[model samples]
Target: MKTELRVAAYAVCVRDGEILLARWVDREGRKRWTLPGGGMDHGEEPVATVVREVEEETGYVTEPTVLLGIDSIRRNWLRRLAGPGDWQGLRILYEARIVGGTLRNETGGSTDLAAWHPLDSVTSLDRVELVDIGVQLWRDRPPLGRSRLTDPANG
Candidate 1:
């Protein structure tokens, strides 16, 4: 009966015709593609968290050119057979430009590889939905504020 809220950041690292991404083998040993960022630490700014996370995950220094948008996911744990609203996460997406460093993976990190994937091929890859959102945000810079949507039932 406890709600767990997690605040995280995601970096859309783009260059040339490719996008930098972090790939990992999950606990089940399945490979997945994810953005180069993670949860924000205490007292850390979202921008700083994104920058640090990108470096840690991809070994590349980056500058946040623009904060694309925020993505929030809320799940009712009770309905999920766990607890009441016990799982939720908020992710802040930022458009990043790689300024330095080489492509490498962070040892002992969640991701085991870092590589650039073609933008056009991204959709074909098995990636999280947030990855598509980040690409859309990069292509279309939405309003400079919280962009939220409510389901019809919620409305």
Candidate 2:
């Protein structure tokens, strides 16, 4: 199988016990709440990527404070255009604070809505694994190196 790697950045902004999240709507019309971020542009710094992506998805101007950790995931899938392949995603997570802007839904973007969810309520929301990994890294603040995520299904 062919292999492809995607490098992305995500922001975790928490204020007043609430976490900012964006609603990711897939091609199949499935929706999941996720951190406000996405893949980086060529040559863009991860920090800059997260800042831009968060603003694009959540309508919030944020300043990243700390590099939380990295989360990686590998999965096998059959794509219509790429055919059968192994896809690996490397996500850089960062802790950020809102500097300006108001909460609003994205227009004609990957995410349709953005909102602040209670940290305690996030556990019950439909979300991607990256969301959990990002939050864990933020809360745990692992030192030394990036935190790696293992594929539970494969393990």
Per-residue C-alpha lDDT of model 1 across residues 41-104, encoded as one tens digit per residue: 9999999999999999998999998888887887766645654666788989998898998888
The lDDT per prediction is: 0.84, 0.89
Q: In model 2, how large is the Cα lDDT of residue 1?
A: 78
Off by over 4 Å in 1: 77-85, 144-155
TM-score (all chains, Cα) for each model: 0.85, 0.91
Per model, how many backbone clashes are there?
Answer: 1, 0
Can you list the residue pairs that collide in candidate 2?
A: none
**What TM-score does structure 1 among the candidates reach?**
0.85
